[model samples]
Target: MSMDDQVFKRQGFGTDVDLVPPFGLLLVDFVNGFADPGVFGGGNITSAIASSQPLLDYARRCGWPVAHSRIVFADDGADHNIFSRKVPGMLTLREDSHASAIVPELAPIAGELVVRKTVPSAFFGTTLAAWLTQRSVSTLLVAGCVTSGCVRASVVDAMSLGFTPLVVADCVGDRAIAPHDASLFDMQQKYAMVMDRQAALELCDQAAPGN
Candidate 1:
């Protein structure tokens, strides 16, 4: 076995969590800025977004509750936080800024929840948790950008709030491959169930009505 696998096995980590429905999908920070390599994009982010297109379609077909998050600060920088301090460019993602807007291809439709926040975790200081809870969402499928940052943070918070977070591996990316892989491993080992798009779709198919 791989060294990491051996270690995790001995330490009793990486347990398989069952995928339960009513499912919800949380897409974090797949905004214009993150999709532009000249801005905050690089690595496999573009491909991740491409792969997520089908996953998003699958979720909609299954009639799952969907939520998306964008990092939007006040136009006057009044809502600046430690996140922006570390990356001052975050302040540029103001309300009217195109950089903070969700990519048109994956944009939210009428009933999808679009959450605006200045923090990494979507659930922190946001109505995402209650929104999911009210919809009886027992499992949350996550797909988005910067796997090492906002995606990781959101997954942990989703678990903390008692939702089974199924992180679609191929649908999440980071600016750097190393951090992206590391974060995926860490999340799989601890907080969430990490699997690729096909596996996730299979689970959803199996859980569908009359299946």
Candidate 2:
């Protein structure tokens, strides 16, 4: 076995998590800013977005509760936080800025929740957890950009909130490949169930209603 495998095995990490019913979809920061390489985009983010289109379609077909998150700051910058201070460019993602708008392909339809936040975790200072819980979402299928950042943060918080997080590996991306791969492994070993889009879909199909 590889050293990494040996370590995880000895530590009893990377346990399998069964796919549960009442699944919800959380699309984080799949906005225009993260899609443009000249801005906060790079690596496989564009490819990830493309891959997520079908996943979104599947979620809609399954009638899963879908929620999307965007990093939007106040237009006047009055609501800027430490996150914006750390990455000054984040302040540009104002309420009406095109950069903070969800990309068209996976745009949320009527009835889907849209969460606006300035921090990494969607649940932080937001009603995302309560929203998911209200819909009886036991398992959350996660797809988004910057696997190392907002996606990871949301997955960790989802687990902490007693929700099973199933991260679609190919449907989440980072500006750098190393962090993307590393974050996926870490999440699989600790916070969430990490799988590719096809495998996730198969599991979803196998899950019975009210399971």
Candidate 3:
């Protein structure tokens, strides 16, 4: 066996699970501030965003239930939660803030859900789980920013909520290389199937009927 394969075996890690039918896509916090280099964005996030554009188009073409999450506070700041207590900067992402808006390139089309959240996991205190279940989504395809934080949280929550999570490796990034790489490794080992952009695209195409 190869060195990496030996490590995976020793660590009790297995390859990605085969995708279940009726997949859905969840995009977490791909906002302007998170995409720009000057704010909470940098590192490989820009490249991840660029790569995810085609995946988003493919999801639409495949008729998947595509949902997006953004960290939006109430206009008056009355909606502050513990997540903001730990990182007060989260308060800056008020309803009117440009930083909290979903990046224009991946804007939600009509009929798609846009979830406003105050925590890391999109499923925590959000309707994401119910929504996905309603759409009969068996496998959840995830693509977004900050792989170490929101993306990781959402992946764990997706697993806990009984949805198979397939995290597109090239479609999620963090502000730093260390956390990005570590999170990808950990998720691949435990929480989700960490596949590349092409792999995810092909899975979606296969899920589409008569493809």
Candidate 4:
């Protein structure tokens, strides 16, 4: 099936519920490679990263258990997986590679968790689900690059793991506008609560005091 077909099929599942859950943040794959146009980066991803900065600051101030994911492979590509097969250059995101490093603006703090993975979904091979559950994090505020790829995969996994994934629309982007818009629509209709960054921030702020 084509990308559009699969996306539409996913959206047919439907997503409608109240946004009443404890919140945390998950910033996915906002690294140098995704930020540079010459590499994997392009389109509105740059704007998304900028939009995520304030959201990150707010998440920190609210004492949320923030987590970030980087798509890294072993230095020797020994850990390459199906993900790398699609984007072979992903194998270059080694431990010491600058392209793998989280953008300076959204870098994780001392206590925040940094999850490194060779897969799309952050929860697939990581302890992200357990970590959030342990911290009583019921609502996951998601932001990242390439909305149609890692972000969408993570959203599905988040739902499957019983977390309310609120995808910040303006805080996630793709190399092109079409996929970004389409993925946001699919996520809103299916796996997650998709909203603008400002709306998401306000929701988190309101939930913070009680959390």
Which prediction has the highest lDDT against the true structure? 2
Residue 136 deviation, candidate 3, in Å? 0.4
Judge candidate 4 against the unseen true structure and give its global Cα lDDT, from 0 to 1.
Answer: 0.88
| Candidate order (TM-score) | 1, 2, 3, 4
Candidate 3 local lDDT, 63-86, one digit each (tens):
889999999888777988888899
Candidate 3 wrong stretches, greater than 4 Å: 1-8
lDDT to native, each model: 0.94, 0.94, 0.89, 0.88
- Write one digit per residue (lDDT tens) for candidate 1, span 58-146: 88988899999999999999888899999999999988898999998899999999999899999999999999999999999999988
Each candidate's TM vs. the true structure? 0.98, 0.97, 0.93, 0.91
Per-candidate Cα RMSD to the true structure, in Å, reads: 0.8, 1.2, 1.9, 3.8
lDDT tens digits by residue: candidate 4, 1-211 = 7777577667665546667656889999999999999999999999999999999998888788899999888988898777789889888888789999999999888999999889888889899999999999888999998899999999999999999999999899899999999888888777899889888777766765655
2 or 4, greater by TM-score: 2
Best by TM-score: 1
lDDT score at residue 120, model 4, on the 0-100 scale: 88
lDDT of 2: 0.94
lDDT of 3: 0.89
lDDT ranking from best candidate downward: 2, 1, 3, 4
Q: What residue pairs are clashing in model 3?
A: none
Candidate 2 lDDT by residue in tens digits, 1-211: 8899889979999999777888999999999999999999999999999999999999998898999999999888998889999999999998789999999999999999999999999999999999999999999999998999999999999999999999999999999999999999999999999999999998888786554
